[model samples]
Target chain A: MALHFDPADLAARRQAACAAVAARGLDALLVFRQESLYYLTGFDTFGYVYFQVLVLRADGRMTLLTRAPDLRQAHRTSVIEDVRVWTDADGATPEAALRDILAEHGLADGRLGVEWHAYGLTAAVGQRLAAALEGVAVLEDASDLVSRLRLVKSPAEIAYTRRAAHLADDALDAALTEIRPGAFEGDILAAMHGAIYRGGGDDPANEFVIGSGPDALLCRYHSGRRHLDAQDQLTLEWAGVYRHYHAAMMRTIPVGRALPGHREMLDVTAEAMAACLDAMRPGNTCGDVFAAHARVIDAAGRRAGRLNACGYAMGTTFAPNWMDWPMLYAGNPVVLESGMVFFLHMILYDDDAGLAMCPGQSALVTDAGGESLSRHPVTLTVAV
Target chain B: MALHFDPADLAARRQAACAAVAARGLDALLVFRQESLYYLTGFDTFGYVYFQVLVLRADGRMTLLTRAPDLRQAHRTSVIEDVRVWTDADGATPEAALRDILAEHGLADGRLGVEWHAYGLTAAVGQRLAAALEGVAVLEDASDLVSRLRLVKSPAEIAYTRRAAHLADDALDAALTEIRPGAFEGDILAAMHGAIYRGGGDDPANEFVIGSGPDALLCRYHSGRRHLDAQDQLTLEWAGVYRHYHAAMMRTIPVGRALPGHREMLDVTAEAMAACLDAMRPGNTCGDVFAAHARVIDAAGRRAGRLNACGYAMGTTFAPNWMDWPMLYAGNPVVLESGMVFFLHMILYDDDAGLAMCPGQSALVTDAGGESLSRHPVTLTVAV
Candidate 1:
């Protein structure tokens, strides 16, 4: 078995999870998040898109109920011994199968914690599960129990994150070579992804944000690839992934010449990013970091151009994005810790002026302050 | 604006959706699926990962409620005129915003259709939405209403599918050049993706499945990659995407020398694939196609190796998977129709012998039968 983490580490994680469940007075946890499954048992598969769950009792006893496609996957990639399969038919209700399993494990009438905020647990399936266990058990929304535990990374996870950061820098280096005028955005994107794969990195949890010209003002990824104009702005938000752990970075590069006030906005963004990093002290809250960013941008009189949220936590995540819990927004109460990692982005989009400037990178919170994981310096280099 | 589909095509799709909603006695549809939003308005963004929905009324009026990042995205890429932004606060409940929108549209007490199967609508959010609108509206699970309409491709959609198929073939051509003894799976995957991007294709809905060694027996994408041994089996399942329309293909290649009984299994898989295609004629149910595959595989005494379901219908899809509605499993009653695209995969994995064989391709259903979309033939090639 090619388990990503050491068996001892995984065992420790399972023990901690069991302790958490016991502390919450829950009999078991119905884990529907793929990240939690991978972190606890090393069970890795995209089959979570279907009706799949890992039941972890307070005593650390575990069982996985999944589809036929992941039957072999559970056996090969995970340490869990009890793996159950649910057949697919026209009206296959796997929740019924799960109820039977709960009965077998003497938990039919027990209180269970559920990862209800997970992408794996769609509303339709949740409704079915609720109905199946209506008179049997009490379902509690303990969606962030595992996520809170994962916010503080172990040493091995940090090593993987650092490697991912290196790959992110390498991807940016590759993109710089292909970001000249008249270059196709598709080719630039291909080069960036190819660099990560060649460096033994894995596919990112989400699509990279690549937009040029007026589209550069947008932050999300959209379809359609266009060639760079002689004078254009290109915004890129990409992550390097290794063992499913991600280190993301964002930047908006100018082709040929920078836009009006673009250089000044870049300076303000850099200052704001520095302030956010400085606010990532061990005693500070996530809101402090966002406040720092907002203070700098608002003081610069660029409030109209700034995004409300600066950035978010980053770790091992699956599709549809790499953003983790404890987003850096105003009034968030999450406290910063030494091992916590974050992506701090200062994005400014002047809609009326059709100009954009964003500078961001991943950082690991340390005893002193925040330390950048990436080797790339934050600077606006015009591509000629 | 860079709308992928023509304005007329989008208008027609909206009319069809409105008709479907009215037929179901629904006053409005709360579309949570990203594919539905993209099909209805060409509004493309991964922002659906947040609390975002497109509200379409029976009268053909549409309004989008999304986060700040997609405010520009909806305006630039889609034809939607009304785009509302939701702030990202600590205790923000966008469901309340949705309720207010419904009330303003005079649908407070009206029956509404909800796409409950969407990844964007997590169980937690669904619970919140239900609580927020309790006694104010009636919600119905109309998950497949838009999906059934999207299953059958229009002429314009077919053009994009054909282009995607060409890109899939090109990706395979590139993969073949890198698949040899002692080849790293990462490099081969990079080559395939690079080829697709160079051909002006978009990012696929999910990560490509690539496995060698014993992992080749598994069907789902898992973490960790391996190198091809001197004599190994490599299984690859990938798709080419054009404007979110997918044409997927799967193949299991042999390295250096074929496994024991592998060549015979390949022949059996090919024969079974041919039977499946022939069974996809008009008026035939999806179950009939699966029965044909089962007949051929079981008759060849390879029942132990074959999968329960052969393939699934494919069209415009979003993250998590490219497989659409109406999977080709036993007893499925969905009838085949013209312009419906299906990916027919004949997968065989013999655990006893540790052999794997999968030969698959996308095809469009016609009045006559299924026509293969890919130019690449279903034949096993041994890499020396």
Candidate 2:
């Protein structure tokens, strides 16, 4: 059977979103991004990828304004959607469209919660809208109101995530067998992606950042034309989607022989990961999880760990909706709740030796305990 | 070798974009999308999938305002790129970010041109920007400026597109041989995607839309549990990308004995597609190209002939680019340049026999003629 959001369930989610906006004291919530729009109404068509904005008022009514093509497609996929199409005619401008949607929705005035982080909302649209709507106060930092709502994993979301986890595991296993000496960095990436695709992986978030040798320290480094060598640390941070839920897993392998320093780094990373999970419970503050990892690493005498943070919240799919709350950083004061998901990664950048790779597993947090979500083994594997 | 764009090349493209804006507009041009940014600075990274805006002024000076982390990544990839970091403290709000960037660049009180047709120039950002930069004239439709600059492909870009075209052809060929009765639609899609992945296809924008039986008419319909019988029509639309260059190809096939009406409909589609290709030239209007397909379908006397508006202008990559201008719409008046690329798709929806299929191909406009990018034959293949 095909996977689709039930029309009735969509209405319920919209209502939840509306209530959140009102609770945050927003007269109208200004949604100017794709993830927020898709999260609200399940509109995942190509046309929705524009600077379209939907204003969901406190009164429970909503209106959207976008280009004509997306308007037609948005109507088709959305369970409850209203559109104001903009073309060359009728003074095609974002300001005009924003003005029309606001006036029609009776949101011409009052406090507006804005996603200040989104692009496409130009200074021009802002100027025209302020003049058209008197007393439109903008609210900042309401991301929690929205992010919290999407944090808890639903049953369907978990099922898809589990599949994503399985694909990640399979990709890594393929990498272990294929990441050999004399192989170009691209060959290992190709084999890993091939495994993911065959396992029914969804659109991968990005390309494989396969770093073999000194390049492993710069995790963001693109897989260059470097050959695998003996005693080199191969750090891979790859994830895939199954249906839309994403699973991110990191694995570090010694290409041929394991040096004592590399083996010790992996050991410390594993210990830190386990300690963080030990503090992960329903009522614990997010800081405790961070402290747990930090304490474990500190006790192990590896003070300069690569990661200084905790995990993030997971959701229905990848990229947009699959986000993690930075509980450790930014003083995020939310308690770790049941049904949350995060990736626990540990690293230590040795300024002298470059990036010391020893990051651990990805997992899904439950009220009972933390469940592992990686296919790679916890221990370091020494290649023959 | 890694792809690169020298600082002089960046200067030339920026000058070209600025000239197009001056010819079409009356003020400062705001480049608010990732694709336009990539077009200008050659900042090739996966971060374009997120919220970032690059402003190209009429005077050829540019300012890119994006997330702090993204700013770092952009700088590492491209040598000619310049970026301003925006974080939660420094104008984290869309309006605040727009206001700060505009004020910094000294465009707080001028007419701001925007690429609103694509990307997120979010309404929320627009509304917020209105308050900060008062009395600014906001105009729409600067996408033409970017599109005009992008319409013609470069030599290196064409080489990448050729590679992508071959990948798409190979995937389609693999899928054709695997089509058999009693095969699950899901399993076949998995297999087709597998072939694409093993062939080193693009991680982003490479989507395979496969539909079987009565579900084939949706054009964008994903395959389902619908069993493939001797009477079913299997339709597929798949593309391959190289360094952001894309070439898409689509085809339809019959499982075994084709229905008499199905074979007739397929023949009409194939003929219509071929006729449209033969009509292409260096200087044809987009509307005229679309009209040619309509005439061929009308001559066939088939009421439900090729229904889509053919395809739009194709570029170095695929969608969300202003480069492939003079799209094949009902009333577009842009002319096809010598280096412009286009895709001609003849799709037929036959209700009587419950069959739908497209014979699609891409072409690059040349001095002598438009050359076909795909190597696949357009005739319907019977799978027995």
Candidate 3:
């Protein structure tokens, strides 16, 4: 198998997932999220764009129903034994095939947990599944069942995150080295990603968020390339991925001499980041982290420029986003635990000044506090 | 605005969308798909990971409901003047905010179209939306309303695709030039992506499908990297993106001497691809293209080695996938239309032979026939 872990480790993960399913009074769990599937059975593929389902029983049995193309994919990448192929013929219903699998496993009349909040299970697919099993079974929206279980990381997973963090540091170094007054934003991005791949990183979960000038105030990737001016601001938010695990980082760099306001904003952002890190220990709530960030910014008279959340939990994820659940927003009740990965960005954008100062890093939650995975200094760097 | 098109073009697109909404007898259309939202108003951001929606009224008025971070993003990238920000407070319900928007627009007592088949609208979110709008409005599943309109590309969209196709050819050339007997797959991928970015290409919707040696028998990208063997086979399927428009290409390369089976498979793949391209005309159905592919493969006695679908539609799309609507599968009745972009991949994998010969390219459907976008030769390349 193409799995990084041993078969025993994969089995233990599946066992834990089954226990979670049984605790929730679900006889069978329909896993839809690609991250959750990879965590449980090592079933890695982009075939989730098509209709594919992994059914895990309370008795520790698992079955994968997928299209013909993914049959070999599942065989090579996952430990799923009972694989079934769903044809793409006209009037073909993979949902019915799923129903048959449930019937064969004696789970037709039992409660089924479906991942209704996942990327793969759209509303139309959910409606079709409900219509197919209306008279035969009961479906419950257990969307967060597997996600919450995956919030805390294991030692092995943490190792992967640390490696990814190192790669991210290398990527940033490459970007800093390539940045100049006349450098194109696209060229810098290319250098950063090239360093990441050379350092043995996988594909990132989202596009690298890079922009310059006024576009730097906006935190998304646009199409065209722009040449940096003599005194310009470039904002970059990217991740280093290892085995689908992400260690995200963000930085705003000045091309030439730094403006006084820009330097002040950077100092404030660093102070807020420190405060957030201090609050990210075991037994503290996610709200506590946000409160710390807010308190630091408010005390510095930058409350108006602060955002609601300062960070979010991160782990194995798919594209369209790398930010995971249990966001550090106000009054979020999720308690921090040891071995949790979090990305904290103290983003302070002064629209009037037309400048942004966002400095962020990924850290691992420990007994004392959050230990930063990235070793890069938080001080603002000016590219000369 | 950061939009590629002028304000008038955006206005005209919104007018067409409003006409469609009125024709369907809907008071307002809630668009959650990133592609549809981008096509309508040029509001491009990955912030859709949060709850964001574009509400288009039947009377040509539009409002964007998004988070605070994306407010400036909307103003900078889109022509949207009416923007609402949803708070991330403890008990903040964005769906209720959506309900309020509908109520303010007099759409509380009318039929509304919801894109239930989209990536953003998960089942749980849809259920929440239904509960929020219950007893006030009728929520109809009009998922295909906007997607069908996007099937036929505009002249401007096709221009972007053509540019993207040229970049794909350049990327392929870079990949071939870098591939050697001892080179790591990761480094090769880095070179290709670096070339794409340097050539002014955007991030692709899907991860580049790349593998070598035994891994070449598998399709999707895996985590680990492997060194190329002297007689190894490497398969690559990647796309060049420009302004979210994708032009995909695929190839199977031999590291050293080409085996007899490899050469035979490549010949058959090229013949099948030529036939498929010949069948892709404006008046033909998608099934006709599939028939041509099947005819060539079956004549070679390699019918069992082929996949179900040869190609799919392509256009402006976001992550998780680039394959668009109107897939070229057997018995599919989607009529080929002028100004449509299609990616046809002739994939043939023989597990017993431990070999694969996949040759593919993107094309534009014209009144006479399909015009190949990629100028790369279909013949197999040996990188010795």
Candidate 4:
């Protein structure tokens, strides 16, 4: 079974992670974040909801502890050779099994880095694992260690993100073609997702945010599907996911004729987005990009409608969300490095007008500036 | 904004939850699980990935603390009146905001119930929250308090599940029609998802597990869509979710004619599923159903191929997974009750032959036995 990445690439990632652990004075690292695990070993599985842990020793030994169902999955997807399965039977303690694995690796009394902020490591599981390792090992919080390493993408990862961007553009085109007065939101969503899948894109970490009319004012996937009203607003926030690498896009479309405040909102949002993109240079900080967004919106006297953060980092993320670290918020000092992917969304919601105008695009940070990954125009799409 | 259910229905659910919290001697319940929040207040949003908390006081006061993006979302979808938005500004402390909310509710010195096992509460966030409440209040792990109440479905919820089942049947039909030699797995998946949306179903809590060839042996959704071989096995496990209510279905299909071992495996899986369904009576324990599944598979000398748990309780759930509590495992003393839904999958993976046969169905427990929710046939689907 071949891995998702080249063996050499995966090995380099593992070596870098091991070096980071050693530099941090940790003997071993217990990784629970699915993205970190995939980045290190190419192990891609949704079985992390259950008790699954990857023990990466600084000496280059790696072990995966998972359930029986994912045994073959890890074998096929990951390059890790040492794998163990823990039973879900009565009185079965996976924490104990983890302890035994640590003992076998001769790291029972060593300092271990744990991902406390990871979605894979819940409070209950963390508490149980802490109890199991108490008196045997000292657990240190190293949640952002691998995440920071993944901030910059490799050429292969950037290629996947670029492909995902193309798919997102195609999906947006399909959605625009399907949007019409009296068209059901579900049908429009079907068209967008259908185009994505037909383009060979994988499922996104989160559901696409799509709604019509008043529902568009809200940025969530609510229960019921509404029919598009003539001269109504439709908000769409979707991502094209390829190998868990997401390139997100958000655009608010006019169902028929543009409303009174629609054109103004669109123009301001596009200008703000362009400024944010322009500020995403190699040396600029995330806060600098947010400042650019604020300057444009504030100059237009639309600061009340603009969001605090214009964008965030995007990468190979798991479910529950697609948003990554180093968010483009005020006072965030994270430097923008080349090869980093970002989704800059200029979201402005006017409560008085009951209107929402969000024009967003995904881009790759280059030494020169931000290169647009999505080819779709920033103008407000009008479905005639 | 009208809810999916009646106002009275949502009120009753909140009342029940409040009673449960009071019974546990908790002054207030801090709900984080998306399913629990939705069950109690119809607060449906994917924004739970960020820091969001719902405070439900036993004295009938309710408050929701979330980010700016979800303020309108909570108002439109839920009945919660007092909604507070925490800023993402520099030096913004959401924990402080949460602490203030607790103080305002007079729960500062009270025992508060927290969902420590929930995905909404990461270990880092949980730790910060505990630190914020330290010396001011006591935090108790009441993760399963509301989940246990949601085990039994209301009539309105069951109605939604039945509708979702209908959509699942339609989706399966679409998938079967699209499956053939040389067909792309992505296209088949597209067809199924498109059918589901057109049938007015919502996005499922988890990605549909669809794979072919050796990939079918793995339960998780891995990357790469395969072109079906002339002789290949394909597995599909999907659910049709309606207003968060889910009715799941799983089936294994042969691209061409059924192999020699395929029929035998299918027969054994179907028999095991039938036996498990028969044992799902109102008074029987979850283990009793698992025992029946074990007996059937063990008698066939295929016990090693089967999983420890035959099925699990299912209902409204969020992303990352769809499987719910009270799993049908050996020695689990959770008793079956009327209105409880279960998805019994007789998964048999014969790695030696590289063959996987899983026939599953979702059902509702009744006085008469398990009533099938998914109308799809529990037999091997052969696409010739």
Candidate 5:
């Protein structure tokens, strides 16, 4: 078995989850999020795109219902002993199978917590699930039950996160060498990913956000790759993943030459990032971190370039993104806690000046303050 | 604009979708699948991970409601003129905003088609949407409407798929050089991805499946990568993505030496793959393709070694996987059509012999037969 966590650690995690379930007055929790499944059982696979669920009872017994492809996968990667497979065929109702599993596990007519917000449970399937279990059980929405527990990292998780941070730094260093004028965005992106993989890192949960020239102002990953001009801006947001734990960083580099607006925006971004990190200490709410960022950026007269959210929590995430719950946006009540990881990015898109500056890095929340996860300094990177 | 399709092509696609909506007796179709959004408007972003939706009316009018980050993105990449941003805030209800948008567009109390099977619509959000729009609109599940249209590729889409096939070939050629004895799976995977990106290919929708040694018997991607021993087997399933169109291929190679069982399994896999591809003509059903694979593998007494499904349709896909609709499985009944692409892999995992062999390639269904997309031949690849 290729379990990522120690058996003892997994047991502790599962016990914690069961405690959470008991506290919520639920007999069992239906695990739908892939992250939650990985956390409790070390079961990992992209097979969650199908209808799969892991039932975790308050008594600590666990059962998994998944497709055939994941039968060997669950056995090999997860510690869960009771694995059930739902045969695939036309008009096959996995929801019915899941209902049967619930009944088999004494969950029928019992109050159960379900991860309703999970990507694994699509709307169509969720509807079917609801219909299949109607009047049989009381299903409560416990979307954040496991995620709240996962916000704080254990020692083993932190160690993997630190390794991911190192790999992120390596990726940036390798990309720096390939970011000179006339460089193709595709080549630089490839170099970054290659560096991570060469360091035994895993594929990130999402595409590395890459855009150049006029596209530099965009923070999202979009199609269409282009070559860097003699004087162009390139924005890149990428993560290094170790055992699915991610350490993300973002930077906008200037090619051949740095314009005056680029330097000004970079300074503003750096200051804002510093303010955000300073406010990321334990006892502070996630809103406080956003306030610090907004204050710095708005005080610098760059409100137009600022975004509504400065950053978000980061951890073991699956496809679609590395962003975890408790996003650092205005008025969010999620409190910062030790061992929490966050990617604090200060993005500035100066549309009027036609310049962009984004400087950001991941940090681990400590009792004292936020500790930098990345070794790269926050400064103007002019790729000459 | 960095639209992947020409304006006329996009307009035609929108028109076809509108026609589908009218045929379904709906006033508008709510597109939650990113593939459908990209197919109609060329607005590409992983932002679909959020509650983003595009409303296409039966009259061909279109509108998008997304988060703030994608404001500029939708404008720059899509032809839709009506892009609405939903502010991010604590207790923010984007579903309410969507309802208001629908009211403003005169869709209130109208029959609306919803893509309930989309990854974009999580169970939680879907429930919220249903509640918010209750009695406001009659929502119908129209998940397969757009997908059915996407099954047949346009000339432009086929061109991109052809380029992706070339990239897949390049990736395999690069990996072959790095798959010798003592090679790390990470290094080989990196080489394959680097080759694709260096050739200007986009990221695959999911992680490229790479496994060696005992793991070669498994088909899905799993954590914990290992190195190849002096005499070992490696299985890889990867795709080349160009402008979001994918052409996937799979191969299992032997390192240093090929065992007798490996050669035997390879022959069985190759013969099954050939039979499957031959059954992929325009008039044949997807079930027929699977039947061909089953006949070849079962006749060789490899029933225990073969999987229930042989292959699946391949095309524009997002995170989680490249497998599209109309999976080649038993009793699928979906008929093959010209211009539809499919990835056919014949896998044989012999636990008794501790050997595995899988060889597959993407093909475009034609009037005469299935045309191979990959240039690589199916054979036993031994890296010495």
Candidate 6:
């Protein structure tokens, strides 16, 4: 039997969110992004019913007002001290609820921070909020505040992620068994897609890369109906989201017998990936870890080593509320702190042939070392 | 048998797009956004392929390049003459291919219009392009270009859209049958999710919304799950993209009997929707159409009538991709020309609840009248 994440744990998560927000020196971080909202409140009800202007005020009052039609659910999944329903009447918008919160917190004269990531906030929401709130500062990056809180996966979260990884591995096994020279990319994708969902997953939740033959040259190649050639390299980059957590790692291998270059390229990438994995630690900067992979490629004397061979933080969503402030895109200097869960992928792409290898490796940072989520062996495959 | 849309008719859509792009006084356009790329290129093998660029010049040279992987499939779909394959060794990224097209067409030395709505060009790609070419201008608004090109729906497009709309309706029917008082929004969404995929439209493409009861109070009132109550209004926004065409519409329904105010609100919205549909016609400005809905709301003496209505362009994708500069959002003052395909959704929402007759109607702007693509009757049905 599968383990279910408890609804009660939402309260603890909310408390953790409150602490993170306060530590960041925010008055009350407006958690509007879906992932952040889910991470903080454990409210997954749709319609943004739990889509809240979550005000985790400095005073420890976790107040929320949602627009869900089922008020009980808003209460069930959330640990908010107060819940308000949005009706079809005037004075019931998020803007209105925000007004009451401001007045109650004596924030009538203080600045209210707004989360800038929502597509719903539209340009109109900003204007409307400005017109509504007298003194408010809508900051752009509340994402980092709550994002850091999710870096260390809860015990439950890791198990769920491992399960997701298992699903991906199982799907890949099925794909390898079913794939043949004459198989269509779309059909093979359909097989993988069906397996994941039937095996208990949101299939579309996992992105797929099932390119074959010469198509594997496209950096972000999409699978198609091309008859897979005998000596083609079928590169796959598919991952699934588990209970809002993420699991991403990829590998590419040959159909029957690989071409000389195909084998060389795959081996080089694997070596680079291994070097990068070995470099992960609690005290390293994002770039330092990336250099591990870059150095491997340079040592191999490849014309171009790797491009963006670094991974960003991964937790509840494919992309969390915000990537850790600094990243490994060269200039970003965000350090790898203990308890950070990063879905790292060292990838390269050729826009011309649409071939890409987003061989991602996800790991959790610890005081001792890093631990990977996937159980798939690093060995390359040659389908018989 | 499902009615298949004719690919031959896409030529007219392309003509409209080419004309719209030219009218913008630009030499060439770089299609980066998925909807625009599909609209122009029509190659739909797993969308989300990395940077498939469609470059159309003023002299009518339309070329699509990205990777060699898609080159063979590209031949089967695209009508464009230059189907260049971008290989890793070729050093041809989509950006590079775009630059070459511009230089070949003498467009590199001047302003080249681009899809500003796209995510930032990847740093690596940007570095390569910027180092190669200097003094290039990027224009942000091509809304007019898309609006005009995609405005008029071909007979084939309309049929596909009609079927798409019906598919959503069919999916909703399946979703509701599984909805019980204690059933979860997540479960209901999952049920519909299975039906849509099994029905053979690939995946749901996006997450399903199953908010009922209090969850309906949220903006875009939908989410993963919440327990449904007998007293709650079950609302859904759904669509299916079949053959790369979008058919979206929404419904607000009660799980059991209508609540005290649900029926009245529904009736008001229905009346408002009817008023808007009746007023749709050619030669009318989008502003005029918006005003027509506002007038109906005003005549009904509802507190606010126009606050929730939608101005949508009809095609394969929803929102902005269907067309260019010819949008129906507020402040857009385009003339409603004949042959345009658009949708009118009149809705009302606040903190307490959301009520509306949505995806109000799909219509073709004609010299004589407005023709609907789908004709499902508007009514409240108690689950039998």
- By lDDT, the best candidate is 1
A best-first ranking of the candidates according to their lDDT comes to 1, 5, 4, 3, 2, 6
Candidate 4: tens digits of C-alpha lDDT, residues B331-375: 889889999999999898787898889887899999988998877
Q: What is the lDDT of residue B9 in candidate 4?
A: 92
lDDT of each: 0.90, 0.62, 0.87, 0.88, 0.90, 0.55
Best by DockQ: 1
When 2 and 3 are scored with TM-score, the better candidate is: 3
Which pairs clash (backbone N, Cα, C closer than 3 Å) in model 3? none
Worst lDDT run of 10 residues, candidate 2 chain B, spans B316-325
Residues B202-316, model 3: lDDT tens digits: 8898889988877787778778777889889999999998888999999989888788888999999999999988998988999999999999999999977435889999898
lDDT of 3 by residue, A34-127 (tens): 8888888888888887778999999989899998878888888889989999877666798999999999999988999998887777777777
lDDT, model 3, position B65: 96
Model 6 chain B is weakest, by summed lDDT over 10 consecutive residues, at B318-327
Give DockQ for candidates 1 onward, in order.
0.78, 0.18, 0.70, 0.72, 0.76, 0.11
Assess every candidate by TM-score: 0.99, 0.79, 0.98, 0.99, 0.99, 0.66
Instruction: Summarize candidate 4's per-residue lDDT along A276-369 as a digit string, tens digits.
Output: 8889899899999999999988899887743668889999999878998878998789999999999999888777888889888899999878
Better of 2 and 6 by DockQ: 2
Model 1, B1-384: lDDT tens digits are: 779988999999999999999999999999999989999989888998899998899999888999988999999999999988889987898989998899989999999999999998999989998899899999999999999999899999999999999999999999999999899888998899999888878889888988889988888777777788998889999999988899999999999988668899999999999998899888999999999999999899888733578999888888876888889999899999999999999999888888899988999999878999999888878888
Model 2 TM-score (2 dp): 0.79
Please give, for residues B196-306, the per-residue lDDT of candidate 2 as tens digits. Answer: 545555443434556676556545422123457755678777676655666777777777766777678778887777666655676767767777777777888875522
Query: Chain A TM-scores, all candidates?
Result: 0.99, 0.87, 0.98, 0.98, 0.99, 0.81
The candidate, 1 or 6, that scores higher on DockQ is 1
Tens digit per residue, CA lDDT, model 1, A1-384: 668998899999999998999999999999999989999999988899899999999988888999999888888888989999888898898999999999988998999999999897999889998999999999999899999999999999999999999989999999999999999998998999998888878888889999999999888888889999999989999999998899999999999898667898999999998898899999899999999999999899899843578999989999887889989999898999999999998899887788999989999999878899989878888999
Rank the candidate models, highest DockQ first. 1, 5, 4, 3, 2, 6
